[model samples]
Target chain A: MRTILILIKKEFLQVFRNPLLMSILIVAPMVQFMIFPFCADYEIKVLDIAFIDHDGSRITQDIIHSFDASDIFVSHGIIQNKKDAEKMIQHDKIDILVEFPNQFEEDLMNGEATRIAITANAINTTKAGIGVGYTQEIIGGYMQKFQEDNMFIASEEQIPARLNLSYIYWYNEQMNYKNLIVPGILVILVTLIGCYVTALNLVREKEIGTIEQVNVTPIRRWQFLIGKMIPFWILGMVEFIMGLFIMKLVFGITVQGSIPMLLGITAIYLLVMLGLGFFISSVSENQLQAMFIVLFLFIIFVLLSGLFTPTEGMPQWAHYTNYLNPMSFYMEVIKKVVLKGSAFVSVQTETIVLSVMAVIVNTGAILSYQEKSK
Target chain B: MAALTIQKVNKVYNKTVHALQDITFEIQEGELFGLVGPDGAGKSTLFNILTTLLLPDSGDIQILGMDLINDYKQVRQEIGYLPGTFSLYPDLSVKENLDFFAVMYKSDIEANMDLIRPIWRQIEPFSKRKAGKLSGGMKQKLALCCALIHRPKILFLDEPTTGVDPVSRKEFWEILQTIRTQGITVLVSTPYMDEATLCDRIALIQNGKILGIDTPEAIIEHFKGTLYTFKSANIFSLLEALKRCPLQCNYYPYGEHCHIAFYEDMETAMPQFLQFLEDNQQEHGDIEPIRPSIEDCFIEIVKMNRHE
Candidate 1:
């Protein structure tokens, strides 16, 4: 334990002493939190739209006014002809186009239904779906309103039908992206700091030729590993705390769950990361190779963690792939605790999974270390 | 008592590269034993096994009368290790690196300060400075201080002076000598042949095998052939001429002279060799018999081993 503490001290010193690393630890989480939420949103609004109306009817004009009043579409202009509207759509100046048939209101008054045409850019499939749905609803609502005013339809005695989603974001209530992201970012930061740092720890000794000195010593494998891991673990915690503070103050993200529980989960996750780092160091022959392998694995794990996209929406195979991703489990727990005020009982299964991962990785690392005296 | 003992050790890496094969040697208490070999000669691999950083594929290693595998914890507590390359935390202050190692062995820096006092005194002023900012010699000294901070019964230094300047290397050796006097057993490895003379005894290793192990004087005494140094205006041509001569047993370029060894008696071979050069109009320079050094003995042993 003492040796571990010393190792932890050394790891912290390594992280804090390097100005470049310190800056990265502080700035990366904050900047990523600020930019990603605003840019990569799923909610669709404010689509540019153009129209070609040949009907020359009051009802068609009223339909146009209703579209302008709705917040979903930003009307660009009334194009003079269908050719102008088509040109605008082709040039990508507008995302949607609406056209009305000639004499549409006269036909409607004569008890014949008027026809309308709508076209949308399908490149961004999600955006197109939402935009089209919103436009249809607005037009339908306007027609219903006109019918009611003309007494052509009887008023409902009961409340009208509406979609009451009652969305309960499991972890974060306010849907603050930082609250959702900060914990996962903390996990990633700790993993990056722990794995890369510990991976290079032994390999650097080999590179400098000092590994021979240590190899001849009476130091046990566990002792050296513990010594190397502790410092990085402590540094991982420090970075975690810093990230937590940034989430609360800068992004106004609250820690709804127990702080100690959050920290305990983080500590376990760091052990797994550090263990992985040690395993990489044990196998690598040099610092460059060790660092490269760590980065490659880090990218793979982060992408598969399901932090950016919903895991449920992914394909069955992809969802199972996330099961192997330690980051995915931790992200889920962190999101739950910080946003949903979950207790240990609530995230007990995830906690146990992370603990097991930590043990397996560390065991593999220790077993792989070969100490032959030359 | 042997401070370290390796018996019939064999280390095969990944079931392919045989790093160390049937290696057996021992360092008595307080002895400065050197593992002398070129790069890839299994010096570092041998060091790793002894340090318990690596386990051999087959063999028994004992340090301080304790088995390496069984008594690793106690072994680690009693040995000081300085690897071939600088391995201290580069981003850490010189003092912090020392303190970290001291704490690892469950010893305090203040308690062990006297042990590393000599080397630490030199690096004391820069204690607050990051180790990476230190010069090569300074880093070497800091590494030594960290290794010694635990006050181990034995010290392992693997090529400690490989890249340092000549003066630093000399000073570093002097420090090692002083440490040995304090009743600490030192096992050092170096490829530099000249450094062999400074060791109490050295095991010359090559291609994963020990060529010879003995004191410098004993090894040189066993150099069997009469050695001669031949130099001329055209040195390369002289080497070729000597190689073709029937009297020559072995010939290799050493500095500006061609070192030629003969199987025959020196009295019978020398006069004829001079006369042959005279007859060929190639006797314009110098040719004389000389005493063999450890390096010459090493070459002779390596040559004999290769021929066998």
Candidate 2:
């Protein structure tokens, strides 16, 4: 234990003494927190759209007003022709174009219904689908209102039935996407930095030929591994706190969960990360190979860990594969604690999984660490 | 008393590459033993095995009368090792690194200050500086201090002076001499042939094999023939001429001269060699019978061993 403490102290001195690394550790979380949240949103808003109104009548104008009043679409100026609208769409300036047929109002009044065509950029299939659905709803509402005021239809019947979706976002009540993302992002960042840094720790010593010095010493494998991991574990904690503060103060996102519960899960998460790093170091021949392996693992964990999408919503194979992902479990626990205010009992299953993973990885790492000088 | 003993030790890395093969040697207590070999000559492999960092495939190693494998923990507690490369934590202050190693051995710097005081005092002013920022010589001194902090019974230095400047290399050896006088068993390995003389006894190794083991003076004294240092303006031609001459001698180029080992007596051979050089029009050259250095003996042994 004393030897482990010494190793930990050495690791801390190494991390803190390098000014550039220290600054990167502190500032990266804040910068990522500030920038990433703005880019992350499940609900589409302020979609730039263009319209070509051939009808140019009051009914068509009212339909356009409905779209304007809705927060989802921000209408650009009316295009002179379909060709011009197509040009704007092609240039990527407009995400969508709504065009009406000629004499649409006259035809509609004469009992010949007019049809409007809507075109959308389909590259981002999800965003395009939502944008198109919102625009169609607004136009449908305007037509219903016109029919009722003209007495062409009964007022009661003219009121189209709308499906009222009381979206009870299970974990995050306010549906703040940042709250959903912050926890997962924090997990990934810590895993990337923590695992890579610690993995390279011993390998760097080996490369420079200093590992022989340590190998000949009285320090045991477990002590050395613990010593090397503790400082990074503490650094990981600091980064977690910094990320939370940024989310709360800068983004105004509230943490509804117990702080101690969140920290407990975070501690488990860091152990798993550090253990993985030590395992990589044990297998690697040099620092370069160690770093490469860490990066590859980081990429795999971040992408497949259900950080960007719901694990359940993913394909059956992907969902099952995520069971092996330590980051997936960590993200789930963090989100539950910070957003759902979950207690230890509430997240007991996830906590146990993380604990099991920590034990397995750490044991493997220590066992793999050759205590000899070679 | 034997400080260390290895019997029929063999190390085959990855089950194919033979790093150390059938090695057997021992160092006496308080002896400054050297393992002299070129790169890839298994000096490091032997060091690693003795230091308990690597397990030999089949061998019995006894260090200070304790089984090497069974008593590894005790062995580790009593050895100080400096590897070929600088392995100290680069980001930690010099003092911090020293303290860390000291703590690992369950010893305090204050308690052992006197033991490392000689070396520590030289680097103490820059103790606050990060080890990565220190000069090569300062780093070497710091590593030596860390290794000696616990005042172990034995020290293992693997090519400690390889990349160091000549002056610092000399200083390092001087420090080693002092440590030796204090009765610490020091086993150092180096590719520098000149350093062989510094050791009380050396095992000349090549290709994972021990060529010879003896005091440098004894090894030189045992060299079997009259040796000559031959140099001319055209040294290459001189070497070619001597190789082709009907003298029944062993000749190989050494620096700017062809070192020739002749079975003939020096008194009869020197005048003939001079007359032959004059007849061959070789000018501005000299030939002299000289005492063989460890390098000369090493070459001779390697050559003789290859033939046998």
Worst 10 residues of 2 chain A by lDDT: A151-160
Q: Could you tell me the TM-score of candidate 2?
A: 0.93
Off by over 4 Å in 2: A54-56, A77-80, A152-174, B14-16, B108-114, B265-272, B275-279
Candidate 2 local lDDT, residue A66: 77
TM-score of candidate 2 chain A against the true chain A:
0.91
Please tell me what DockQ candidate 1 reaches: 0.43
**What is the DockQ for all candidates, taken in turn?**
0.43, 0.70
- Taken over the whole model, the C-alpha lDDT of each candidate is 0.81, 0.83
lDDT tens digits, residue span B239-279, model 1: 66665676757878888777878888778877887787776
Q: Native contacts recovered, in order, as a fraction for each?
A: 0.64, 0.90
Model 2: what is its DockQ?
0.70
Per residue, candidate 1 scores C-alpha lDDT tens digits across A304-348 of: 786677777888887888887888888888878887788899899
Candidate closest to the true structure, highest lDDT: 2
Q: Hey, what RMSD does candidate 1 come out at?
A: 4.1
